[model samples]
Target chain A: MLGIDDPWIWGVYLLCIFSTLLCLVYGLVNWNKEGEQEALEEKEEEAWEESEEEMQQKELGM
Target chain B: MNLLLLNIIILIYLLATLYLGYRGWKSTKDSEGYLVAGRKTHPYIMAMSYGATFISTSAIVGFGGNAGLFGMGLLWLTFLNIFVGIFIAFILYGKRTRKIGHNLNAMTFPELLGKRFDSRFIQYFSGIVIFLGMPLYASVVLIGAARFMETTLAIDFDVALLVYSVIIAAYVIWGGLRGVMYTDAMQGTIMFVGMVFLLFMTYSHLSGIVPAHQALTDMANLVPAKLAALGHAGWTAMPVLGSTWWWTLVSTIVLGVGIGVLAMPQLVVRFMTVKSNRELNRGVLIGGIFILMMTGVAFTVGALSNVYFMQKLGNISINVAAGNADSIIPIYINAATPEWFVYLFMLTLLAAAMSTSSSQFHTQGSAIGRDIYETLTHKKGGKSILVTRMGIIAAMIIAVTLGYILPENIIARGTAIFFGLCAAAFLPMYTSALYWKRATKAGAIAGLITGTAVTVFWYLFIHKAEAVPLGICKMLFGRDVLIASMPWPVVDPILVALPMAILATVIVSLMTKGPRDKHLAECFRGVK
Candidate 1:
């Protein structure tokens, strides 16, 4: 509380808070994937499923 | 004051990094895998490694100290870190870079340039630039961590510098890129945890969040006459334009590092490690969050340091007391934090220095091994991985020698020199490779030459290019005043050099017609 409450200084602070909040919002919304580990897990799951499907088809053919 | 515990913590951190390097060395499938991490890094590792590699001790020790000295205006860079550094870099650049890098099977920065443009000459030239120029940065980072060690532990500068360099270079030479990443992942963890704790401790030390910030504002509004005249309105204030403060805040630091991140080879190499574009898409959020924590916390704490120094020393800055701005954070650490916290911070800084140093060494080695040795010498080596390993050793040796030779104030000078060079040499080619189908070899060459020449000329002669170039050093009302005041480098080179490079690239590309590579153009096609 310097007591002046300078607009210019406070404006800078406001911008920082706004930007941080904005970054936080965007960051959370986009939190799903950023590193490939999550995607790799999904791909592995899909591959496992496809192999399982192929096994079923072969069993049916037999 | 017990010091043995601190020594043990640093040694343990060093041992872990060395172990990771040995593991990487033993498992490298070939040169490519060793150099580029097999291009199959899981997104989490990739993201953490990328963030870790970029968020060095320099960000924490050097520039964080600067924010404390300069005021809170430097926080703009933290915003840019998330938005541009992580988001735009990943989505806009990372996706395409990974796809093209994989398609071309390129493993190094210069290799990417050469393969993308079908120009080996470009590759070799870029390699030379990186190799010749990176030492300044490597040495500076070496110095940054060393200064912390020297100040906090009261060790000799040379011993600290040598020990840090040797430890980092060993991991990099032994482990290669995979080792760097695995180590980076760990270091990144240390940094994330350390900053989080440091942030809380800093706030607590101030008697609470509200009191801490209020103290900062009180100090800000009452900035010494010299600082006030230069536009240091407060901790939360931006510098006034044309004031000495404005140019420093807006131009040198803000531009030098903000855009410079795009051209950093070590960070760029991380983009190529993943298996797919989707993988790159995944690393974005993690990278952003890590950056927010690493950079955001550092800037916030750095700003808070002002209040601490003022309370303790009866002045806003303790920089002059330690004889270097980079020393501010360390002194603050020792004075304000508990001994255990000091050990943790030392570990965090050591992690930052080692992680970045190892990557810088690896990149330098790769530039020589993959980009130069294989391409230029045309030496059919026994194995490219072998060549890279050898190159890593060679680069480490050079870095060690330079680390010893450099004068004090290593961090700021180190960042500016390497980054300014990268901006000049790589930024144009990078922009062209991604966006413009018409970007020609001539354009790339023109841009490189113009940018490199201009940035160098300015830095050598510009005031802004020199020590704390952010302040009233702009060439307003003619640089004659500056030329008279300083010995050389009266203006910051970026303002003049960057435009010249862009203009040259566009003009040359237009004159030379489009590139012959249809597939190259297609990389940019199918988008808006």
Candidate 2:
């Protein structure tokens, strides 16, 4: 295939191209699919930030 | 090429870079902005920055030269680069890292691990490792860029070194990661264009892809005697398995760099720059294509350059380069490409150097400022940006000094040494931190220390590539390597150290108490 006799070499060459297409397709497919998760993560982020701020305050007091 | 036209092109590019740096400076308002681009970076910028930082001049010229010497077998590295480096990295690691980093309010790679495990010791220890180990890598990159300038622009080496350092330092220190990434995106675009052009030109020059590869494959009998002894079967085929050439190509170059990239602090930090998994998903598209063009083109052109040389000069690439593999790519470009394309290629090299160096400086500075100093002094975020800027200056000075002082042979080994060390020391702990809830602080520390100790021991004693040049083994044991055995000396430290690190992490974690459930919940929140 592709004029190279070695399966190890040409197999890798084809796989590189194939994997790149996989990434492209994955990206396009999931482009807007994370909307609900983003909202949940935002709520979680707020709670975590509050805790981190409290920890910082306690350290400053010490 | 006309000197005046070249100067104008360079000036225009530099001015655009400075303008982007200035824009980054104007936008940076807080420590978050400086440290991780306010964690709201565009997917394109994040992906481009990551790709550009990952591929450097040495990756192009040096490894490309290796491809010229070795064969299409080097394409295995490219396969691993795209599949492992981009796909698995973004899908599996990036999402979790971004979520956990946000949850913990972590700003850097060391900080993320430290905060997760509630271990200041881990934070500062990792920081110290990075601050100390990264200068060698940074200096080598600095030297590559300066040498390119010295040859192409006819500037003195010292002047090139100073000017290049000052330009990168100005943007990186002042604008921080924002400046670095903004400039990186632009530079990465240039690199993409240049590489794509090179691939097309090389194929066209050889009449097309299939015919060109067939021509190279037909020339397999031209393998030099010395190379054949070491394991050179042909240009289109893998080296004889288990030979020195096979071991060096597969173990040291392919696996060492391929797997090692997962744990690189600079690359890992980019995962924290974006806002959500959606951005990372988009980034995967850009990053995969960018890396494909970069390494894929370099290795293919590198292997096929042998065909070009044989047709035009009646010699192989190594012979044409006078046995220096690093010169083969530049020589081929000069001989085969038109003059205008040479100018574009020069910009490509410049972009590659600056992009990689800026990320190194940023990671090093944060290691000292945010991770080391803050943890040690019990200081928090207020003074971090100021201290980080100062740390960037310090790192730049150290890199410049090393660039001036380090010998070329030792300098050439910098990237591999750093990559191998990072993989050995950090990969186990980093993976455990992300995935294994049972992993304990004690386990992390044990893995870290064991990994570091084993890798250092290997380099100083067992790994012939480094041990010979370092001479610690020769001085102490009176041998080139501690083990004068064949494949043992050729085996990379990561192959030995990473498994040990994983075992240490797993065994010690099982033996010790895990982190509190509440903290683990906090870390794992939204991680899936």
Candidate 3:
């Protein structure tokens, strides 16, 4: 196809380009899918961190 | 190129890198910030860091050099790298890893596995393996960057090695993952621009894409007798199926690295460096294009360098390099590109090397300090970071020493070896940790040991590429390989060890008790 005689070689060459387009399209389609959830996750993560710190302090007898 | 101008440009780049490192150091206020970029990295920075750390000088100088010798067959690795490394990795693995790691508060790859399975043994064992096994890989990367410096700047190799190591270590030890990823993003941009220019110049120099491929294909008859005997048919064709050349190309070069990318400790940790799946979704776009530019340009330029050399000097790339495939890309850049581009590409190679080296040192440090030492001593928080900094120094010394002692043309093979080992040893357990709820602590440990043992045994006793030079088989069994038979010695360890590890993991998990329901729930929390 691209002037290379081997189907195996040219097939992979085309596939590399195709795969990148797949990623670009996929990213664009879902760029903002979970926008609302991030804020909630951050709050939960902070709570989890505080509890984790308390548990570690208890273990160390601090 | 003007040495004075080049030196000033390099100084600016170095200063900029150090400035970014300082910014990272400034932001890092706790163990979490140092370990995982505070787990809220930007999508662009995360994607660029991942791609830059993943590509490295190994891809450009080493495998690009292999493309010079072997042909466009190496493009299959690029296909797998994009499809598997970015797309599947980000969508399928990244989301789950981020959630699970957050739930368990796991900072490193070993800690993730350790926390998931509730086994300190798994964490420390994996940590020990990484600490012991990664220097060979790191050293080869050091050698790749050093070789380019030697070739382009006319610097001594030893001086290049020492200077490169010190620069990478200074930032990695102080700034941690935050520093590594920040610099990686900037370095990745430089690499992207340099590679785009390289690909454009290559095709334009050869009069465009089709003409370049046609020229390479036309020169098939020039395949050296030695390479042809090993089943090298042409620069544009696949090696004769099942021939020695085919096995090395497919098994060692292509699949070894292509599939192996999934389990790399350094690359896999990037998945846990983000807040939510949205960032990963966005990252996939940037990562795909970045990887395409990096590997695609290098391999294409590597292969077409032959045509350029043939037309100019009536010799092929390997001959021009005097049989060292490692030198092909560097030689081509020096001979084919204009002077100004040479200076830009020098920064490109430097970025490639520094970005990856920084990540390796960080991962190795975490393995030793966070995973092994902290887990063993029951110490946590600030003390571990101090130990981690020490570990980084130890890793730097080992890698720099190896850069001095390791033989020429070892870059690509060394990289493949580490990737394959990680695939066999960690992939099964890592996969099971994410997807298989039934996977038990006993099962994970068994799989880890069996995969590691089998890979080490194969490298020492059967894989001729490593065994012959290692001479362990020759000393123990009075032969180069325990199996001197055709194709047996040629088969890569990943092909052998990975399947066995998977089987052991599945069967052992089924036979043993699974993790407690409470632990499993904790691991699976928020992990849709």
Of the candidates shown, which would achieve the greatest TM-score relative to the real structure? 3
lDDT of 2 by residue, B440-497 (tens): 9999999999999999999899988889988988899788897887899888888999
Residue-level lDDT tens digits of model 3 in B1-528? 799999999999999999999999999977888899999999999999999999999999999999999999999999999999999999988888888988888999999999999999999999998999899999999999999999999999999999999988878999999999999999999999999999999999999999999999999999999999999999899999999989999999999999999999998899889988989999999999999999999998999999999999999999999999999999999999999999999999999999999999999999999999999999886678899999999999999999999999999999999999999999999999999999999899889999999999999999999999999999988999998889999999999999999999999999998789999998998777
As a whole number from 0 to 100, the lDDT of residue B415 in candidate 1 is 81
After superposition, the stretches of candidate 2 with alpha carbons farther than 4 Å from their true spots are: A40-62, B406-412
TM-score of each: 0.87, 0.95, 0.98
| DockQ metric for all predictions | 0.09, 0.56, 0.68
Model 3, residue B267: what's the lDDT? 89
lDDT of each: 0.75, 0.88, 0.94
Residue B132 lDDT in candidate 3: 90
**Interface root mean square deviation of every model, in Å?**
10.0, 2.1, 1.8
**Can you write out model 1's per-residue Cα lDDT over B1-528, one digit (the tens) per residue?**
478877787778778877877887787645556778877787788988888888788888888888777766777777777777887788788877776675566788788878777788888888888888888788788888888888888999889888777777677777778889998989989988999999899989888877887888777656767778767777766766666667766666777777788888888889888866656666775777788788777877888888888887776654534556687788788888988888889889988888888888899888888888878876533345567777777777787787787766557657866776787778888878877778888889888888887776565445544523433334444442345453233334666677788899899999987877676654533232
For candidate 3, state the interface root-mean-square deviation in angstroms to 1 decimal: 1.8
What is the Cα-based lDDT of residue B481 in candidate 3?
95
Ranking of predictions according to DockQ:
3, 2, 1
lDDT of 3 at B501: 96
